[model samples]
Target: MREIVDFDNLKMYINGEWVTAQSEKTYSVINPSTGKVVANVPNGGRNETKQAIDAADQAFKSWSKLTAVERAKYLMRLYALMHQYKDQLAEIMSLEMGKPFTEAKGEVDFAASYFEWFAEEGRRIYGETIPSNSPNKRLMVIRQPVGVVAAITPWNFPLAMMTRKVGAALAAGCTAIVKPASQSPISAIAFGRLVELAGIPNGVISVITGSSGPISDEIFENPIVKKVTFTGSTEVGKLLVTKSAHQLKKLSLELGGHAPFIVFEDADLEAAATGAIASKYRNTGQTCVCANRIYVHQSVIEEFSEILVKKVKELKVGNSIDPTVQVGPLVNREGLLKVEEQVKDALDKGARILCGGKRVGGELTEGLFYEPTVLGDVTPTMLITYQETFGPVAPIIPFESEEEVIQQANGTEYGLASYFYTQNISRAVRVAEALEFGIMGINDSIPTVAQAPFGGIKESGQGREGGHQGLDDYLEYKFISLGI
Candidate 1:
């Protein structure tokens, strides 16, 4: 059965009202599964973005003044709504982003976890009382909301990325303007409805979809937008850093990652191979923390490559809406082209393709579907090794020693996430620290959780998301003293 999404009557939410876009333009969202246009998302420009920010700014004065318990109630309500609509949101994500339905559901569920986590954090937001050295004097520190926030998210994991930012901001009592990726705006718009159903105040949360460049610039220029939170490529993240710096606006970014999965000798080979299948193939390898480069010790390279090749070959590449499919198409034509170019470059640079490396014949030729590819004999100098692939391609390279592999993994300009497979506890600890990344996995690929802080290091971008600390990004501290 083909799924249909209605976007014709879509409108931007400003001050709790769904209003028509100032610009009479729309973009067609194509289903990568069948190469069919599923929805017509409104192409909002700078004007709509401004309206959202202004509304949020006006709402923040009252919102930030509310008691933490009151704010927590709203988040709790939102969380309940998300749970009620998880299936629909997951289906929408699969249709829009080309992720396997099961994985999409997982992301939707994870997204809901944010609301729950931050909602609890709301009641627990604490201020410190510092003891003074002088007699008859008291000192204390307090934390307060940073005011209106501009949250820009990517298309890969629409729901999770949006909630990761907005959930914390709302829990901290900040109003927000969400500018979701233009490519996949359906789920985000659906999220807007959930906010309303949850009894959130007008302008406390607004959704703006379309061209983000001009809108982003406007929001950055607006003095009322006290913070900017984004999740995307490092190149764009750098620009936001500079723009935020101009006004010294508070910023949190979860940018690009080329996570390396290292397999050392004396490790559980079977477990490592299975882990790779899950980590590298999730969301068709579109995740920021997906394992792109596999660094195998020379002694185990041949065995690991053989097992990995067999697994890659077994991946069912087809429509994301199909429950049985394991891998889906890329997000769009541009992504397909980028992956094609990277694969071709690797082959040209003496790398060998072991399994699937080309597009498959399906109902959608124009749709972006790249085959799950496995490349061997990749050199450290190739772009695939140092740069993020961000597709359904996994390249494996051989390393002789732990020291050499660690150096190779850390060579990239990006240091978002890295993984290792070894039974030696001491070596795991040693290699974990040696690898200069924000997140690491020992015999695992999934490093993020609602209880643990997630972010990157170096050029992978700045700040953290998820966990109890996620709300800290939205708060500023003040110290006060009293003396007789």
Candidate 2:
């Protein structure tokens, strides 16, 4: 990838001011692919977070008073600025998080798309008048901003997740404070430049980095914050859900995912193979919605496995900067170890590894790069069959019948995304309906987009993230009755 942006010491953006932590301490952020220090991000504490929350709280009064159209105009400008700096944003994301250059650029587009989409959606935030039983009475419902919002984003898709939450919140006329994951904070910090260039008020959008735990505690306890939006693990989400109950603050949690990908006997062999590969290997399978459990009809398991292994072998595993690299390193050491554990546990339990099951370390460099692995004879008993192994490992589980496959697929705590390949129209519709997941892809590998509502159910997570309902989490309804 061609380099374009300068990586600088990004301090915390709080209360319309660029400031460091009260203690003047910082933490080192590492590039996963190169194993090099990227920058020293501010180690913000309660003091810094208090400043951000206070700014957002104060700004909300004027910011929410603006017409949706006015707020949307600011978002439109933001969208344009995001495009203007797309190359730089992509480079920063790739350097910070190790996504392939091409993929990072695509992520830039996906993130910017939310601003453009929510800009239009903001203008259409409509009010409705209900028919009154009495002639002198008038009843109506109006939508309003949910007040100050705190968006906690994950490291997997730093820029996109930040925009997904912050864009919608801003469009809903809510001021926001974004806390990016410690693993990758540069993308979130650099995004402040675009918001500033767009002329959005400083407190209307703030990006804070540092000790997220203390920052979150202050936000949760403060009465100024009205909503908490998070995209991370279910464990942490449950903790937030429990703590947010103190003030009963609204919450939007897009948590963990253990998605299932199914391939029936009637599926196009080539399509099924490539679709599974696309869903499983993207971001080296670090995505929450990526296919973790794959089910293949017993009749076609051999051919499906054969074609999948062939394609998995063809993927070029290298640094994210390499344009030709299809698979990149894991985000950190924990991710690398998690993948290693899943593969080891599966192999120990009698699962067969067809290709690429070990870590790859080049002599010239040391990084967290694991081979794109494929496992066969995966049983429901194996840990890899149900665990959310967020790695580029495709474990094909054979099923005897449709009923059995659906039973196996839905037999998990997560219900984020599910996929199945079938030429049978009726069967496709039937299985799609039966699968217990928020997003379903029939004959499709990837189904998420800016225009759709993306989220999960059960233990996967709660609430929606995109499309018309994406703004729903940021707005509240008020009913009015007038007597004349």
Candidate 3:
């Protein structure tokens, strides 16, 4: 066994074992930056998924019985190891997921923080005694882990999202089987190496990569998996919802998001533009929290757009491994195609391409890289504004009144995040309160933190993923009564 992970050939982790699929099935992990094969991974189908699920189930009996303090030690160890290999982990993510090297490194740090945060949180999982209504009666409520968890994370932010679910679930004394997105499964496998180094028990953590259909079926049907945590598209989340209903599994779905970035007339133009750029282009705008719609007041739209386009033009798009590059390729060909379609639709609906609307060419021709695009003359009917663009394209729409902007922002069914910049304290407070979203950024660009509650509302998905509330979804409460 090589101590250094080899993405050229990868294996699924099951019951503390790194092995290939029993059926010898495999899928190639492509480097989105090069359109080249990075590695071939086990296409762990139903049989493989079942093996991981069973391993998790068997481990759960003893793993869940461990004291919360004991479990935290393993998580802390994992966190330390994650930090030690942070650079290597970031490189793998950059290659596999098409994130800029700098952003990839940042994601590794974010991932480590989740484990470190949860390590401390594990010991704090407390219960309380209830006030009995009747004399000579005692009542208490206790929290317990919700058994085995199947955490399905997306290609975007693969490492951080997986850790977000696993850290909290494991901290709650629950075992987990991670099914990472096929496009970026190596990051998940690399994390499994850290879990192994942590000296955690066998079967306590598992990773599987394969087609979603067969793999998802086994995970949902497995009676041993009591809870499921998923972060992906809302449509897929809905499918999981229907599938998990047969077993009534505990579900935490952090699904789709169409975040709105609103800049008021009175906002500091520099800060407003900077916030727009950071919020809109991080992860090349694939993040669920990425600003999808840029709503600037009619009074300041021109100035804001000018500043934003200047910054956007300065962004260097290239291979993700280039440290100086600020923008990278989309995750895969489909992502590129989606962005293409959205831009075309917007153009057909009369939206103007202010700076970028086409793909970049040169030595970087092999990758799925799209230029950082800014669209003006964006209308309410344009497809780019209505749908989750999930690209570096920012559509700057104009609004007149605070009430009008709020209505436009809340019009989308997806409400994962909303951002507004205003110097007027009253306007900021009013707009933040009125916007329907799980996360709000009032003048701040990147608002996500390990200590803050992270998630969305309505079709954007359910359940929180961080802060003190992160562990709640992975746990269940039991009430006890005694008559003395």
RMSDs, each prediction? 1.9, 1.6, 1.3
Ranking by TM-score: 3, 2, 1
- Per-model C-alpha lDDT, please? 0.87, 0.88, 0.90
Candidate 1 lDDT, tens digit per residue, 102-136?
88888888998888888888877899999899989
- Top model by lDDT, which number? 3
Tens digits of per-residue lDDT for model 2, 1-484 = 3333345657776766677788989999898888999888889888888888888988998999998889889988978877888878887777788898889889888998999999888888888999999999999999999999999999989989999998899999999999999988888778876777677886999888887779999989999999999999989999999999999999999988888899989999899899999899999999999999889988889988999999999999998888788899899989899898989988888899999999987741587899999999887888888778888899988888999989989999988999999999999989988999999999999888988999999987888988999999898999999998
**Model 1 error, position 399 (Å):** 0.8
TM-score of each: 0.97, 0.98, 0.98
Pick by TM-score: 2 or 3, better one: 3
- Tens-digit lDDT string for candidate 3 (1-484): 3444876668888999999988898988888899988888988899988888888989999999998889988989988888788788888988988899998889888998999999999889999999999999999999999999999999999999998999999999999999999889888898888888888999999999889989899888888889999999999999999998999998989989998899988999999898888888998999989999999999999988999999999999999999998999999888899999999998998899899899989988999989999999999998888888889999999999988999999998998999988899988778888889999999898999998899999899999999999999999999999899
